[model samples]
Target chain A: MKLWLTCLLFACMPAWADAPTTPTDAATWLNRVAQATHQLTYQGVFVYQSQNIMAISHISHLIDNNGEISRLDALSGPPHAFLRIDGSVYCSFQNKPSGDIEHRPHHSFFPEVLPYPNTHLNNFYQVRSLGHAKIADHDCEGVLLIPRDAYRYGYALWADSTSHVLLRLIKLDAHGQTASQLTFTQIDIGHAPTRAQLSIDFNDKLPIKQSGNETEPKAVWQITNPPSGFHRVTETVMTLPDHAQPITHLVYSDGLATVSLFIERQTQPNTFHQQGLVQQGQMLLYTRPMGQYQVTAVGAVPLATLVLMADNLAPIERK
Target chain B: MSHLAYANKPHQTDGGHDYIALISAGFDGELDDQELLTMLDRHQSDINASCWQTWQLIGDTLRQSPSTHPSQLAQRVAEQLKHEPTVLAPKPLRAMHTRHMMSLAASVSVVALVSWSALHLALISPHTTQLASSAPASSHAIQIAQIDPARLASFVAAHRDFALSADSPDTDTSTQNTAEPTQ
Candidate 1:
């Protein structure tokens, strides 16, 4: 009777025994990370490594009644500070006369991965939990997002078990080797940043030059063929500092990776240049000349993707 | 305390240090009469038998100085040769006056070929470095010099606001992708 009771007790144990210490559902775990980033006030230093190059930047995020204000100071590079007040960004470089301001929709820097809508993700990626790991002195749950197709890269993300804040991220190539990695070496969460830490001190003499001016020119160009799962997120006209005319810019994203297309009318005489494909680490650049206008596509995607998108650009005829 | 210190206690035959020491000695051919007898006794234990086999393989590797077998090496060589380009014999020299004309034509052809190759290399050279650097082993400097940190900072800041607003259902409808005319 005693032996039977013991066996029954063992079999009747709670289902929580099989459940992971962290959330198993990738969407919920990722959403937790995104929520923590916006709601929590924290300060930390993160290292971005791609290939042989590594850069260290200090970030301080503060939330108040007005909105969330954050500051990023580069510790490794030359004197550079980035201050973001809600959606407006103010950047100050040691060489530049004035800090440039741009208003755009963006997200977290360290844990750049968010739970993008997973409606079509299952077809392209295989998401799984890599169990648990210790990162930056905190116990974290590792999640692996493996790409099923060759069109995209894979990612290994580690989110803090307690706070749900992302601790480490690794971008993997097709062969499963790490292509780039981002990790928070040290983090102090729950501590609010001071006013001075979140503030940007701009040059008094020079006015802030807003890039991608609100004046959005009508987009006459269209991408005839975009890869499946990608959608047009935004279309706007950006008046660059060096150029006299405004360039039409179109942004596309598949909820994970983003690609920007800049269509500029080339009017400079004797400016004929060799134009095609150029790459820097993960970012690929593709340029295609169409009559007097040059179309440049930039993204942190495969070279083939950029080439395809660049080649399929068509001018829309307006009646 | 350290695990190693705890493991070295007396009355622990399961630790297998004695058997490992004997195996090392046997591998080095330094096992004397007493050590050889000790190894023979330990060989009865299943753990020591596995360790003994591993030690034999290690001894064999050390004695032979690790290398592919001759047959395997020959197979690999043959496989490589299959991919290698074959060398053709030079054409027999032509007769006197025709040979002079042929030699002049050959010189001109060689110059044209060299110039064409050089120009082709020059055109493709810059792009090759950009692509080759993508390989993990290549030591290509990050081409982020073109990325203005100031601009990126502004974009990130702008993105923060978008993320915040996008999270809320009520305020989401307010910010439409807007485009104003350039003044």
Candidate 2:
């Protein structure tokens, strides 16, 4: 009887241990996704699709004592690769050296799509779980973020049930159409990629055009009526290779989405004189001539949001 | 929005008004054989040729063809001129017969096209080509220009930098430490 009871307890203990301990709430799952993105060591091949375009890429992310390092190589189209180490991004195109090592904040790509845990995502997005599904042979629970307003797009995310890592993401338009998608077709978790896999050799002899350093300039332009939830994040003046005059760049973000506004004086005789709107995949661009300056706004938000920001842009008196 | 109104307003024109109309008609693909002859004849004028080159630049920029460099275009134009068969030149229209209404319409279209082309050029990048390959075909298919890939890159790069920074670990409000994968 003692032996039978001990065996029975051992069999029953497996059932207890298998019971669901994973959080069912979407916010907790989102937090887990964010944490896994930054903390985990993983490598995978993912397919990114937007409208009629589809691209396959390989991504390898590793977390070490020096912090996070990642490499993404495009497996389709023209050869392009990006190496991100902590906050810096280095890119190479057509196997040619991209001269500048840009020092900027992290830009989330596939598997790293969640906003930081501190963002007020709940205020702008209704987060809910869409149950479980199998992705890349891994059982994943889906989290849907429905936008509360028309200003921003919605998102649906699938995170691994056991590892809590995000495996797939779908960007939804205002009408709930899939505007873009990124899904891993194969992935290996909990293993660090070899250093050789992450190395980028820039020994090519192609002439590399240098993107000069950026400098912060005084805020002379202001948007009087920006869309709600959107706030200015950074403003700087940078010299573009083609433009003779410096362009003032301003970035605005509503937690998940971002819009960049570029302002430059119309010094050239052939400056753009017409106002127009264009859409490419999920991105929208609006440009209008403002007095002697031309303003161009680009973002992945709705056209209304871009128009509102561009129309409200006004010059402010510096104190 | 007010800029649209400003752009639409008519402005004073120089002696190149008639040439501008012909250039605009050529861009719209509405030029006839005779009009083409007249345009080719007027192409000798510095102002008309410059306007023609500008229009070509806009078209080339929209097409994003690498061979559309200004110097290459000039060479191509010279080559085509060398191959042209000499023929009787068409009679030029009388100054009084110049269509002012047509000229005005052409001017407006040119303004719209210039503006449209500029914005398209600003937005397009190599990344766009990689992503826009699957765009649905249409009669009025939108052309993605490549006037300044570097500028577009800067905007996109900056935007991504800031957008992702919001959720970065440095700014995380949660007290949970960045955890390792469960072995």
Candidate 3:
């Protein structure tokens, strides 16, 4: 009888483990989706849509002993391609090589659309299982992340049932409208992509924009009233092209959504400044002119959230 | 010249308020010879020059003309003021018009392509299989306000770096070879 029970338990374990019966189980499934995205080698075409704008891109991701390498080519709109080897990114626009490759601290794209596990999104987002469905003829389990407050947007994620790879993601606005979406039409998981498929010639005298050598400057500005659950992540001072003065950049995140505040001294007296709010797809930018300084806050959050943070930003008075 | 005569007009007020009215009328082509000459003379003043440029930009925007950067407009206006005898003449202004029309044209084409693909995908793509419960369509329309597109694009690019931090420190760097492609 014991031998018979052992066989039955082993046979049913796969199905039992995949199904989420509680909220905690749903969170676990999300964790699995995050893990599969980075650990497995995948190549696919995904469609990104936001409001009236739509773009299709082909992405090839490879994970080997040398770390992760991904090449993304835009199949629609303007001709452009992005090659990411770990944290560094290279770009080619209109078949012309980019002059500099930017080294970012963290970067994410379509399939790799999840926050770090340590972010503990469950604190701000209520994870729930939306059951199962088929996407691109592959069975997928759906998970919904509903925001606990109005400060942040929500997300609906659908992961492959067999591999737990995220196949689709829909970002929802505060009113539950689809703010933006990314869905894979076809995917090849676990197949190693050739080196040539993930390679981009940086040997053409293209300078690498190094971020590791950048030193963190003293924090001279502070956001007095950030929205709920949002906290400062990183701050740095860097010289942007065309600007004579260095810009102070601060990054804030609520795990999923991030907001960047840029402050620069106004050197030219006649420089025309752009003020007020601007919307680009799911993102919002708010610019406010402080005394002798230009302050701008850019993020995927709502206009009110940005306004609240931008209005309350104050410079630290040094003795 | 006519400007010197208009600058000495008895009825002209010393305050910038009178020039402001003339500037507004100049945009509508309602200024008479005397008023037009007076407006041109006042255009040299720092306050009046700024006022004139703002009114011109507003008129161009209302007429659905190609959008130009405010700084660019200021530079062109300053250049015309330096070389051209008549700063407010329509011929000089029209010569420098629509410097950034190509970007606007590109934006229109991109929108058209996106609309076409969205319809095509919905009709034929197998990935349209909806999984989540359908919510009521939002009635809200996004309003594109007056802001510098180039400056906004830079901010958006910077924000993207932090927005998508997918790789976690806890993420296992070791590759998983057991999974197979679902062909």
Which candidate gets the maximum TM-score versus the true structure?
A: 3
Worst 10 residues of 2 chain B by lDDT: B174-183
What TM-score does each prediction get for chain A alone?
0.79, 0.81, 0.80
lDDT by residue for model 2 (A1-319), tens:
2222333444345344334444445456677788887789998988877766677878888887767877777687546566666555555565432233332434455667666574566776666555688998999987666666666767778888888888888776655666778888989998867655575443332222224547777777788888777888778887665567888888887767788898989886447665776555466777777889888888887777777888889988766
The lDDT per prediction is 0.55, 0.61, 0.63
Winner on lDDT between 1 and 3 is 3
Model 3 CA lDDT for position A49: 74
User: Which candidate, 1 or 3, would have the higher TM-score against the true structure?
Assistant: 3
* Candidate order (lDDT): 3, 2, 1
DockQ preference between candidates 1 and 3, better one: 3
Clash pairs (backbone) in predicted model 2: A52-B134, A116-B167
- Per residue, candidate 3 scores C-alpha lDDT tens digits across A1-319 of 2222333444344445435553344356667788888778888988877766677888888888788887777787545556677566565555432222223334466688675464467776666566678987788988677766556667778888888888988877656667778888988888756766567443232323423234468888888888777888888887654456778888888767788998888888636454676876567877877878888888887676777778778987889
In terms of lDDT, which candidate is strongest? Answer: 3
What ordering of candidates by TM-score runs from best to worst? 3, 2, 1
| lDDT of each residue in B42-93, candidate 2, tens digit only | 4533333456477677656544566767766766766666577634335433
| Cα RMSD for candidates in order | 21.2, 31.1, 30.3
Residue B4: error of model 3 in Å? 99
Error of 1 at A110 (Å): 2.7
lDDT of 1 by residue, A1-319 (tens): 2222333334333222334455555556666677887677788888877776677878788877767777777676445566666555455555532222233334344553464444555555556666678887888887776554445566678878888887787766545667777788888887856766467364322223335464455766777888766667777766654446676777766666667777777678424333555554455666666678777777766655666677778887899
**C-alpha DockQ of every model:** 0.03, 0.04, 0.06
